[model samples]
Target: MPGCCLWGSAPPAPSGERKGAGWLELLLLLLLILSGWVLTQQPVGCPRVCECFVEEKTVKCANQNLTEVPPDLPRDVQNLFLTGNRLRDLSSGAFPSEPLLELRNLSLRGNQLEQVGAEAFARLPNLKQLDLSQSALLWVSPMAFGNASSPLEELRLSNSLYNYSVVAAIAELLQRGIFQNLKHLDLSSNGLVSLPPGIFSRLPSLQHLDLHNNSLVSLRDVSFGALHQLQRFDLGDNALKRLRNDTLAQLRGLPWLTRLDLGRNAWVCDCGIEDLARWLKESDQVEAKEALKCSEPEEKQNSSLVSLPISGLECLEPDDDQTQLQTSYVFLGIVLALIGAIFLLVLYLNRKGIKKWMYNIRDACRDHMEGYHYRYEINADPRLTHLSSNSDV
Candidate 1:
């Protein structure tokens, strides 16, 4: 039993720890567990002025009041949360190391961030979701998201943007080949009156666009020219008094546009409203407002849409400019048609005169036909006929 305790029988399996051997084995098991846990909890050295901590495999830091940018975090953390922080400045090399950073989701929402550097976000190679909503971002670097290799799928900047310069900056970046992989973007509750032409010209992958609760007055034609992949567009809560026919018509060409929001607007439901209603009817999805309210007739504004387009009110033409342009197009078309008709008539008359001249020639030939035939007959007789016809002479 001493040397052969192989069963129950194994002497109860050495009831207590076997000193050195048992202690070493237990220590190795504990080390293995700790190692497994370490793979989840990455290194977070800074415990001052920031609440950066490792939660499972994520690095969550938020509600901090740091003035400047934070340091480079653990290279392995995929989800980094710095929401509700007071991060104001964003300089280059302020973000953590990337590719190795492996950041997929980054949340900087509810922060006092005002300026983000140009190359601040370009360093993240694996980033997919970025949340900068509810911040005081006065300006976003036009080239911030440009040439980004990361597959950033969603970007939130609504209710945080404070300036229209952001549009120009974004427009500049788009022109300069920025925002390549961006799919979703939000800029609602901002201050914007109008957008530049060809501003959103290259965002082919952008699907959802939020411009709700903004100060947009009019949506110029071709404003959304490049958003062929757009599925949802939020234009709710704006100061648009009317909708241009050309703008709505061009926007209706978006192949994937499924949802269009026009609520909470000062929509007069006038002729401009008619254009939008027409767009809604032609579009796949839309919702009309409850009713129309008149803007008073013969007002100071020299527009055709003085009275709003109530259900009883007729959908007359809104502004004179749009109608003038339409009239100009029509007049030009009519002029071209008349010119084409004149050309065709002139060609027909020339052909008729030529035919008459040919008729006179035919008459003249008839009169000389008998004399010519007699001369040819005598010349072609006898020896000529025999030589020419049979070579029998």
Candidate 2:
């Protein structure tokens, strides 16, 4: 009787309430299981060898000893770094069949890539920057970027082209107008002796050009004529002897140029180098002006180009004149020799005619001599003349 009053006791929970609580508990357990599974699993669509940052949309497969590109790259990965791998060649099918529509940066540095196929990067439509540094790139197809207009802006090929042929290949590739929008080009440490004329003519938008640590001996005035928008240029650590006045003038005319590097070169401080020395002393654009010392002429050796007086950078005018005169004499001698050779060749070609002419002259001379002898005899001996007249009668 003491516990019999159901109204006094708390009312029992409704079946609907119990059912709802059970359902909530079940949902929470399912959520917990899913979260655990997700925590244990790799990122969705990420390759096993690569680390993918989903939030940033970057995938790093560097130093993985990958023989080929990871096939399972995230569809939305914007920056893909495949550096320090063993990828020897980038064939047409190196990337996945599905194009990475958002990929912006690609790095293949430190690979053993010897060749780049024509369609190697055809799928990366929106790619902006490419770094192929430290690769043993021996050959690159002229159409390596495919037929579509490239949106590439920065191209880093430093220390990649091992030989002149490879450099020439890249030069040919550049002449094809594939990377017209390129803004920054790094060709440093490539041992380039000389660049093909008009190689950078198509890259009108080029701003930064790095040609340091090369074997370039000279540069043409048109070497950078197309780089009107160029801001920074590096020509350090080369075998350059002098920059002519016209070349210096062209460099001075760059409207946007802010930095110029001519240090560590084999600068010959002669009258020929006076223009460069004067420019270095006057302009604030040259970097490491102190390091641009005269590497030739024992007296001027190690002298800083900027500090050297323009008068000090002089050549013996008399000696130059004598040298020019000697050179002119040698040139004249060569021309005379060539003319003599040509005349001899012509005579040899008409030898038969010449011989006939000589024979005809000898015959005419002999005939004239005989007639003269006969006339003299007739004039000297009247008896001989009378005998000749009797024979005619």
Candidate 3:
């Protein structure tokens, strides 16, 4: 068979300077290739200072002397490290305004963050771990971490501003169950004096709590009542003088609690401290118990609070009623002895005068008795003579 001529007759092409037209087509194809190459060389919207790893979905922009969050980060970044920067404030949409659906870990440690707005991290829906440690964080809006789409597991706010208002705002969130799924929370070195009652009750999944290096003077029984899953509790380096029985008893309910740090506190080894000492002696989970020294009561100052026996702890001042009763008895005995001594002294000083007055009274009585007897005898003579004559007749 004659080869089937599929291309019987092709349409005639437009006539031009045929050689020049071929050259123009070649030039256009070269330009297109060069443009494609240039576009590939530069990733679209990648921040200049940030180093993005596409395969790992990570952005490492740490310690680059950045004044603010780098703009136009890849939307798919999962881990972002912004540590050691000059990020002063986190206003609304301060970071990349684009939604980051895969972002999980965000670190802002060692920054100068003075304020954090309510929606600062609203674009990150899947954020799980956040580190704001070592920042000069002075203000945090109550809704700063609100509206998170994912369950935040870890939050580190350590060594931030020691502001009560900031802590109270966090407390408000805790009370409202905003961090119910939080597992690890670091609130150390915040100069907190006392935690709000039931502040940690809503976080049922919390495992580790760091409250060390604060000025916490005491804790309420309800302050940690609902933390059943707590494994580690740190109360070290605080200004706690003693813990109440209810406060210590509340800890007994946490079956999973394994480690407790109560060292480096201002413990007072007094009668009121027996419960704490007994608790320490009974529980083996307390770490550094021997280092829990006393900071009050000159007699027990600097002594190991945990080692002191419950019987050895005594009140500096005895019971008021007992003391008053003993004092009254001593005072009464002294007064009675003083009265008796005075009576004896008076008798000894007036002994001669008393004797002379008794003698004079005796002499006058004797003379009056003799005179009465003589008068009676003279009156009776006539009757006696009459009686004798009558008997003789």
Candidate number with greatest lDDT: 2
- The residue ranges of model 2 lying beyond 4 angstroms of the native Cα positions read 1-41, 312-393
Ranking by lDDT: 2, 3, 1
Q: For every model in order, what is the number of clashing pairs? A: 3, 0, 0
Tens digits of per-residue lDDT, candidate 2, 1-393, equal 667676587768999999999999999999999999886656788999888887888899999999999998888999999999999989889999999999999999999689999899999999999999998898998878899889999999999997888887888888888787899999999888778877887888899999999988778534677788999999999988878777788788888998888888887777877787788887877877777788878888999888888885567233231355578899999999999999999999999999999999999999989777777777689677665532321
Lowest summed lDDT over 10 consecutive residues: which window, candidate 2?
A: 316-325
TM-score for predicted model 2 compared with the true structure: 0.70
Which of 2 and 3 is ahead in lDDT? 2
Tell me the TM-score of each prediction against the true structure: 0.61, 0.70, 0.67
lDDT of each: 0.69, 0.86, 0.81
* Candidate 2 structure lDDT: 0.86
In terms of TM-score, which candidate is stronger, 1 or 2? 2
Better of 1 and 3 by lDDT: 3
Encode model 3's per-residue lDDT on 45-141: one tens digit a residue: 6688987777788888889999888878888889999999989889887877677889899999999688898888777777889999988776787
Clashing pairs in 1: 7-10, 146-178, 269-309
In angstroms, the error of model 3 at 300 is: 2.4
Error of 1 at 34 (Å): 13
